[model samples]
Target: MAWNEPGGNNNDPWKNRGGRDQGPPDLDEVFKNILNKFGKFGGGKGGSSDGKGFGLGISLVVGLLVIVWFISGFYTIREAERGVVLRFGEFSHFVEPGLRWKPTFIDSVLPVDVQTVRSLPSSGSMLTEDENVVRVEMEVQYRILEPYKYSFSVTSPETSLSQAFDSAIRYVVGHSKMDDVLTSGREVARQNVREELQAILEPYDMGISIVDMNFKDARPPEEVKAAFDDAIAAQEDEQRFINEAEAYSREIEPRARGQVNRMAEEAQAYKEQSILKAQGEIARFEELLPQYQAAPKVTRSRIYLETLESVYANTSKILVDTKGSGNMLYLPLDKILERQNTSNAPSTNRRTLEGLRNQDPAAENGPQDTGIRSDRLRSGRN
Candidate 1:
């Protein structure tokens, strides 16, 4: 019967002897007997309990090994790590950063760095769609997003990513023009390559997310590098010239517009002034119209004299065709006026006043006689 079965081995070996009840072996006696057996086995081949002592030593050794195995199972994961656990060489679960324990010799943990960014470089001279070759260098930054996939999904995630990088870049370069690969279209090419790379990598799902992709440098091949450099320099110069021209336009356009506005204002002011002057002249003529109607001959003579006076004031010479003269007379009126002006000098005027007071009244018409003589001489010249 089993030991715990009722009415069976109570049969308890400690209490039963030869099917009769004997008090349990005394504790003191049992211990003493074990010690004596140990002492005899250690001293010499003098006891029959040697095999039992050997068995006890084996049990103690097995227990110590078991305790060591349990203790070694305890492990600590660093803050920047993720633990990928595998049970019996197959994926099980992931563990976070902290102290953790697992069944000894039954599971394994692979720590992967998830927080750090990794860089991969790609560079080569590749052909473009326009049958041109360009040397390109690029850098790709990535981080692990799924540790399980990083460790178990692929044999080599980095290598796969590198291949994908090459494929994406070559595809983009092959479809783009050489100018795009090497010059102003660089940013556009970079964006296209990144998008293509992401598309290519999507199916693989290697548990890596691209942090950034930089187009480090792009240049022409060695055989034509100098020529390409010249072309690039020319393009830069063209852009610079265009920018300077635009700046000049921006600066000059406002001044031109302002000049137009100023000219327009001046013309408007001139128009208003001319209009007002014409209106004033018309009003003055209207006031004279009734007088001319009442006395045509006197009004006509007065108007002619006033017109002559206005014309003479602005002129230095006059022309006169005498009533029956066959030729024109040119009068040097400016010279006569100059002589008359000199006669008003301080000393000359004072002398003339004294002379006039002592002289006869017949000489009072001296200036008039001289003016008439001047007129006669002007007519004789004609």
Candidate 2:
């Protein structure tokens, strides 16, 4: 069952043809046998042909390795990216976005995204100008403008930019009041931080352009939040009140102007009416003057009589003549006016006039000649 048993044929599994005990095969002889097989390909018996065949095999291996290295050097850049070439671990040049190649070991390419916007946010509780602490959060958006500077100008551009942002934000916060940082002054503080950050990064040339800076949030500490909210509310109310007042002023001003215009128009109309009335009066007097010049006595008598008739029509008192005897009748005007005002009846006034006309004058006064001028009045009329 077992080979090399004592009573067995003493057979070796490795085929020991010498029938002698051997430890193991020698590595030198095995390699020589392999070389002999390869030497047969040269189809020669001398050592010179074997050496040439070995050299050819070594050259083929080297060529394959060189081709692999050359192919590995070729890379592609994306549409939004640029490649920064480094030669022997130093900055060489920049490459545009496309398929490109370089010496495998002699040059390297570092692709940097140039078209993407990067954001950096910085937030912390900072001391304000009034010695109050306020938590401020801000974000800076930037883009790589120069790939070379972004890659090699500093050890780490992003770290340096972050530090610059911190420094600028702190400086701005330190110079601003707490109320302003928390409220109406956030925009001003944001602008100042952006300007100061740009200034700080100017010397380093980090190849970053600040597209925008936003004041994300600003607030007081938790302990004083309620109080600040109240203050802000009061400020808002004050603004609302001011706006309302302005709106009311705008609404009322037009109405007041309209009223003033209407009053002015009314006054103008009254003035025009008075001027027209005066002109008409002047025209009437001018016409009357000519008539008076034509016949002075007749016009004078007619004017006197017209004046008397107008006066008598307005008065309640009347003068009556007794045709049979030289007697004058006196009518009580006060009693008649009192009766007329109390009754306001035309019949009462007529009855009073008729009773006075039919009264017996002889019984009341016996022949009282009251300077009778009836004949002169009649003569003037004629």
Candidate 3:
């Protein structure tokens, strides 16, 4: 019965065996009892109740330990990272990003960031094909491609890459002249070096892909800095002169072509005009051939008169051959036209006044129709 039960006092754990109402069990007695129960688990003669409670405690502790060990194996990988799993210090499979689990102390995960681009620079004074020294600086940009290969292919991939760059650059520079290294040959040298580097690295399978390789600097030695500067300036000046010549050629060539085309067009028009004029003349001659055969002298005279008319139609000067006079009279018809126009009004008024006077008895008798007579004289003179 329990201690609070109506008739059972032996169920009280704090009650003394002396049947006294003790405050609590003695410390020595509690310790002894626990030791006796643990001893009974190995076949000691302890109380059955003590052994059962101790057995349940051991089972609960072991279960809690198992749960802790399983949860401890979980790990997380980031978005850009690639994880390589190793089982017992040997290569296993790969794992992706996010929370993952591996057996503790058995499988290990190595996370390598494959997305980040890394750069390595190699620069030094190297000998050229011409036995000239030139300083060159270059950078290689790369990223990890295969995590397992990168981890296990070579002892140290970055160091190997640096050595490879040095070797390739030296090889290319050795085959190139100093001027090329410093100027137009820089691009060729860069290409050659990259090609050579790739060739050297392919057998090793370093698992690094070279994104780009750049020749950052290619220059002469500092000892000859002034000379190199002058050389570079002259090269620039030569390029500038060539560019200017090209620009001038581009600007002036079209104008010359246009002028040539214009001259050709004008010549073509002149040629067509001459051909048409010749055709018309041929037609005219063919028609006039029959006329000449019908009346020789009359056709000849008619042709002469037609020629005179064509010539005189274009002339503004009038030449008058006076009768029996050795000297010919010359008059500018344009000037005569202007003078006649100016004096016409005054001449008409004078003529009218003269007629009035003649009608009156004060003027001497004159021929009738004097205006008509004057007009006839003017026409005869013309």
Candidate 4:
């Protein structure tokens, strides 16, 4: 039956025992009743048991809250990261990679990647040392080295690094020539910028190390880009020409040296040959001197005959009989020369030809067959 039925007891679902107009049961009273049940174990009286129960309940709640806060502070650091711990908003220490815990409300942890290289780019139109404006772009790569300084040395390490990069790049570019920034000096400029950036950041101890700096792009303003391009091309061409000339010199120098060495060798050989030939001739003359001094006339005649033989050895010979009828008779020495083939044939032929040239007409007084005999025979016939 509904509690409000006329025959049944009227029970007010929303009323307490005082029955005035309570909206719901009082939470404090409900809690006290529940704790009193626990307090029964202590065997306390009415008010003392209730008070003891409330105190135990409050202690349990505080202990549970403390445990939850401690557990919440536990964190994990990755392999590539470092945890920068702070005690009451002040730098404390660095935590390595692993599961770690800290006082939840007292200590805070900031995880930073120390192994990863971060890059920042700086680019702008800057004036060079040569009073020329060039658009330059550069990249700065860095890694967190000291997490404490990176977190506390400055409000923002990345922002500070970026500003430092700008400063360094501008300083380097301002001191360098436009041609160098855009040409063969790019590497030098990149190294200088990296050094300058490191120097600038060292004073602040931003806890970041400059890994490298790259010269990304360097060019003149668009208004003058064409002219700069032409100049760069001309410079490249000049370098190419120089390299080619050097290569040519390298190639041709060896060949020229070889020729010079060969000529020197040939000259030395010729000099040796001439010296030996002169010595041989001097020895021969010395040997002949004693023979000439022993028998003067015979030696002289022998020398003359040898000289004649030597002279005739190389010439063709023909015997001419000029004493016959005022006409000359010629002997065919060429045919005889063709028939003779001996090692000493030239010397024999030379001696024989010389003897024949010197011979007198056969028995000059015995046979006087001249033109007068021809006249006597003609008169007899008449």
Candidate 5:
């Protein structure tokens, strides 16, 4: 029954509807009053209901914010990179290549590319050992080997790396000769730079590994380039001249030595021939002297006859004894002598006069005649 029914007493019959001993209001009424209080649109009471509604709405917004906060803590890492987690600005752990999450607002993550090669160029002017200034250009290739160290050990790794490169270049170049730096020193310079840079980075814990370094160009300053080129050309010309002189020496020295050796050999042969001929002539004279002592007269006659025959073989004149024949035989002795002195002397001197007999021979051959015979024998020997 409703409380505002017309049949109801002015005292409120509904008050007694359940019973005077009822402990509290009806359950349905209690629920109805609670719904009404919540459903109010305006006023302090309505505002209180609105405050409850606003509290509920605030709770729902707070729940969504919490969900988003949880999601924001999660992160992802790619295959080529490594993640370093820092808890309160200090390194905590490392994560690799996948989805990962860290405590929100309490931890931070830094991703470093460990596999990718990074390049930095270094260039500057430096003094060499020869006290020459030159410009050098080079590139360094590096990669991160320790991600945690790269992220946390140094505040600025790239800056430190640049400084290391500068120091290495200066140190290497300062000690090198200008010519070497411009030419064959490129390889040496790269090696030195790599070593020095590695040392510097290791001490600072930069976590960088140098893969390779390359020298791009090294040259003298623009003001001195022409002079350097001229010097190089001069060096080349000097080497060429030296090579040509050496070649000429090689070609001529052997020929000159051979000619000298040939002359020496010819002189030696002539001396040996002269000595052998003198020895042979001496031996023949020794043998003939013994034979002549055994038969003096016979040997003398034979030698005289042989000498006369050899002397007159080519002569047309007849030598007749003037004492035996009063008529003198006119002989061309001058013509025979002239012919004997010419080109046919050797062959003409070989004939002998065997059958000529002297009608009026001179008494014994005297010392003058013997001297004449000796002269003829000596001439034939010669």
Candidate 6:
């Protein structure tokens, strides 16, 4: 039975002693009771004292937390770095070097090394314009210009930049010749790669500024390395040969021209000498012709005698006069000549004959007697 039922518990002392208050407390009454206790404990002097102490403790904790948070947000940037501030996941502004701060949890900051030159190396085997494969190694230097773009515009700026660099290198390599890639074309390749990378980054809004691109090494593959080396050697040899030829030409050309000039001068001198000699001979003949016409017989005889004298000037002779004694005088001239023979026989004989001719009044008869004596001597007559 229920507790209020009286049939079984009429004699129960607990039930009969007090009149029944209620089955359960009403919601309003319970609420009012709690409110009254709360008001009584909260409104009194003791209660007010406890409430103020608790509020003070809470404020102290909150202040400490705020100080700690502020200290955490107060970061200093170095001279080489730039700070990027993001509020509520949006770019706010860039902070310069030195002390900087942002609200905790409400704003975020990223420090980028803007002034630092970053280097990235890229390498790959690429096909050139000549359809030859070559390995190209290069280095790219860059720096951040816009901190906001660097932090938010791309998910990973370095990775994206590297990808763009690879694409640019490939594009440039594809358009270049293998010989150029291995030789003087490296500078061109670097410029083209830098330009292409800049173009790609511009569209992606990347904040990277390309400082320069340098080609470290570029060469043909190992399979063709020997052939390329041989080709280079051959080219060097060819250049050496060309230089040698040029030098030879440079040294010999002037000498040849000088020789030609000397020969021409000699020929000209010969022509002048021949003309002067011919004119002298003609003048001499013209001068002699007038004398010859004035005294023909005497001039002719003189000319004949001069001609004979000139002809016999270098010869040895023996003379005898058979008409005066009517006897041939055997002079034994060959024996006398043998006895007088010396290194200066011709000069001695010329002097002796000249002295005799100067002393004799009929010197012209000497040669006539010489011829007759020679004829008698040949006939062995005395």
Local distance difference test values of all predictions, in order: 0.79, 0.80, 0.79, 0.79, 0.76, 0.77
Model 5 TM-score relative to the real fold: 0.50
- For model 6 the local lDDT of residue 92 reads 80
Q: TM-score: which candidate is best?
A: 3
Tell me the tens digit of each residue's lDDT in model 3 across 1-382: 4577887556666666587766665899897777666556645554644666666656766889988889989999999999999999999999999999999889999998899999999999989888999889999889999999998999988898999989999999999999988988888888899899999999999888989988899888779988998998999999999999999999999999999999999999999999999999999999999999998766875675455344444445453444455455665654654556544634533444445445443222233344654564355466
Tell me each candidate's TM-score: 0.56, 0.61, 0.65, 0.62, 0.50, 0.51
Regarding lDDT, does 4 or 5 come out ahead?
4
lDDT string, candidate 6, 238-321, tens digits:
889999999999999999999999999999999999999999999988999999889876676566556555555555556554
Question: Cα miss at 267, model 4 (Å)?
Answer: 2.3
Could you give candidate 4's per-residue lDDT for residues 1-382 as a string of tens digits? 7877888676768765575766676899987777776576545565455666667766777899998998898899999999998899988888999999898889999998889999898899899999999889888878888877888899888788888888888899999998899999999999998888888988998888878777888888889889889999999999999999999999999999999999999999999999999999999889889987897666665565566566666677665554437455667776777787756666776567456435633212222332453454354334
TM-score-wise, the better of 3 and 4 is 3
Which residue runs of candidate 1 sit more than 4 Å off their true CA positions?
Answer: 1-51, 252-382
The alpha-carbon deviation from the true structure for residue 309 of candidate 5, after best TM-score superposition, in angstroms, is: 52
The per-prediction tally of clashing pairs is 0, 0, 0, 0, 0, 1
lDDT per residue, candidate 1, 1-382, as tens digits? 6766887446565556777778666899887577556656545255544556656655766899999999999998899899999999999999999999988889999999999999999999899999998889998999999999888777898888999999989999999999878989889888988899899889887888989989999998789999889999999999999999999999999999999999999999999999999999999899899999998766765565455445545556553545465676565756655687554544443443345325434333433343564566477565
On residues 261-320, what C-alpha lDDT tens digit does candidate 2 reach at each position? 999999999999999999998998798789889976656655554444455446665555
Query: What's the lDDT for candidate 4?
Result: 0.79
Clash tally for model 2:
0
TM-score of 2: 0.61
Candidate 5 Cα deviation (angstroms), residue 347 = 54
What value does the lDDT take at residue 346 in candidate 2? 49
